[model samples]
Target: MTRQRKTDAPRAPESPGGWDVRSEELVAEAAVSGAETAAGSGAVSGTEAPAVSGAGAGSRPTRRGAGDPVKALMHRHRELCERAVDPLEIAAGLEAHGVTDRTAARFRHRDVFALAEEMYARVPRGEEERGASMAPPSRRSPDLPAGWALFALLPGVACGLTVVGLELGGGRARFAVGLGGLLAVSVALRVALRFGPLRSPHQAAPATRAWVCFLLAYALLGDELLRAAVAGGPDEPWAPSLTAALGLSLAVAPGVWCARLFAVAARKRLALSKGLTEFSASVRPLLLGVVALYLCALWALLLAAGAVQGEPAPAGAGALGALLLLSALLSSYGFTRAPLLTLGAAGAVEAGSVASVFAARLPGCDWIAVPVEEAVQAWGPGAVPVIACGAAAAALLLHAARVLSRASAHADETP
Candidate 1:
């Protein structure tokens, strides 16, 4: 009945986006009322007012999958393999792609193995002729001068001089000669290590190897002189006793030096089997020639000195010379096989030799001591030390040979 009179239908306020103006006005009024309530509540609680958004609308966007670093690296690795790129070039590429040096270093071997396997698998059996195209460029090391091998003989000169000093000279002269010889050998070794034999990967620098051998010879001579000087001159009651103990203790010094030299040489040749073989082969003959020359020269120098000084040579001097010659030969053989281990073994032998000398000179051990003492006296005051040194050297050489042979066999077995 209230609508009985024909009235126009109620019309809603229109907006361009199909929203109504009346509804918008109501919503704005409600929002304003809520904001006022919130402000009042904050004031009562002494709290800061909440931040309001300045935007009329807002939206949140999620990140999409662009790439995986590791996957990208694998792809790059495959590409490099297909192209047969140099490993150095590939490494540069990896560095540019955000792979840090630390990461590359940590994964170096693994990455190399992976790359190698990838390259190996890429080779086609059908295209055998094309293999040459993929081969790494051949590189040859420059040929060094032939005279480089002779450089090792410089230390031999020191050895020869030291032998002359020990056998032909008086006590004070012997001591001075030994000290000078030791110093000379030391200097020669330092020079060889820095700029001579160790300068090459092949150990073909005969000069350095020769120097090492010469150093050994000089040490032997020096040890003899040191012991002889300590034992021969003074007649004090404590002199013999003190000499015996000192001789035994000091004997190990030369052995230790020998071991250190051998160890250093071995470390230098650690990964170079071919070079080691070539070096050892070339040096063995040179060493033999040098050793023989050294011995003959030692005897000649001694005879010449005795004649010059008008002094008779020590009793059994010629007979005992054989012991030294034999010892030198044995030692040379020992140093060839496995230098470090041989040297260590030689040290043990030297220690035993000193003990033997001590036991030989021990009072009340007549039966055991007498024969040993007689032999030692024939060799010269400190000559007994050389017996043990020689034995140690020979043993070490034999052991080294066995080890090297085994290593070669193992290498042959490996793929």
Candidate 2:
């Protein structure tokens, strides 16, 4: 309030047309000052000022070129991304970016679809693309052959039925219906298994199964035969019936197994032929030695049986000699042709008959009362040793022949 001279504030400069020059100048100065500040802070460059208009200028806090913010942000982001994105960093970034809980949870769980979508969005416009339909289809099943399935069930059927039949019948009937049913089922199953659609005829031949069945039947039949033989007397009616059954079964068994062998030989013709040749070559000497021993044993046995009957040394020896010769001849013949196994089998049958006849005659001998006397009377106590030697020889010869036959058949099969 001292000397209050009306000192008007320094007036702003004037402009044409009575405009408020000071206000306009002030606005312009403020804009220039802002631009300088922005430039210093690196938000914009001077060259971009002319292109920005009223609204655009407001939108952009400072002048900038088209790619400026994007380039700068991309550089900054790349630097930040170079620092590994640990779980903690990811969580922090999510929080800082104000990401929703659901979106953040998806990121934390590493959802593959979310990741793919993010990658697709981040890629600069035009790049190679693919769709979900390109993925391969899933496989759900396996393949198997039909023959294996069929063959695998045969053993189960046979064993199951056999057990059931045994439990039900207990040998009351010669052939129980249940046992027969089981056998029938087994045969049917075997046939089906062998001849199933996927099996080869050569591999599934029914003759093999038939042979096995026959062997089993034959063994069963032999028990009946032995029973009949033990029980047989002039007055026994059942003995005759059992004897007949036994004879029939015994007669059939060898033939059936032989037939199966023959079928196998025929199927593998070349192999069998080769095997026969090789077998014959290897076994000739061994067979001769065996035959000689078998003859000696047979003669000794006959002499002992004759001595026990109070007969002369030469009485039964001739017949025994004939039996040995027959066996050797049959065995030799059978080796050349597989059917000969049957002939040899028949010879064995004849030998058994001869032994039985001698055994029946020996009971009335002079040495029947005393064991020592019997031993002496029966081939003079040398009968056992001689018989043992003969048996050993026969066994060796038979083994040699068998081996030779198998070898020859095998050799024939080779190329």
Which candidate ranks first by lDDT, i.e. highest? 1
User: Residue-wise lDDT of candidate 2 within 1-415, one digit each (tens)?
Assistant: 5786764443322322222333233334334334323323445332222233333232222222322322222222333223322222222232333333333233332322232233233323212222321321111111124454444345445544543454466545535744575566556544543333212223322443343343333222322332333233224432112221222222222222222233234323322222223324444544355345544554454455344435444322223233223332333223323223333343343334323433443657423224423433554422322343234334534654554333222222110
Clashes of each: 3, 20
lDDT of 2 at 379: 48
RMSD, every candidate, angstroms: 23.3, 36.5
Per-residue lDDT tens digits for candidate 1, residues 171-228, read 6886787688668755654443333323322232344345335334433343454344
**TM-score of each predicted structure versus truth:** 0.33, 0.24
TM-score, prediction 1: 0.33
- Candidate 1 residue runs with Cα over 4 Å from true position: 1-147, 156-181, 193-341, 351-371, 377-387, 403-415
In model 1, state the lDDT of residue 61: 20
* Local distance difference test, each candidate: 0.37, 0.33
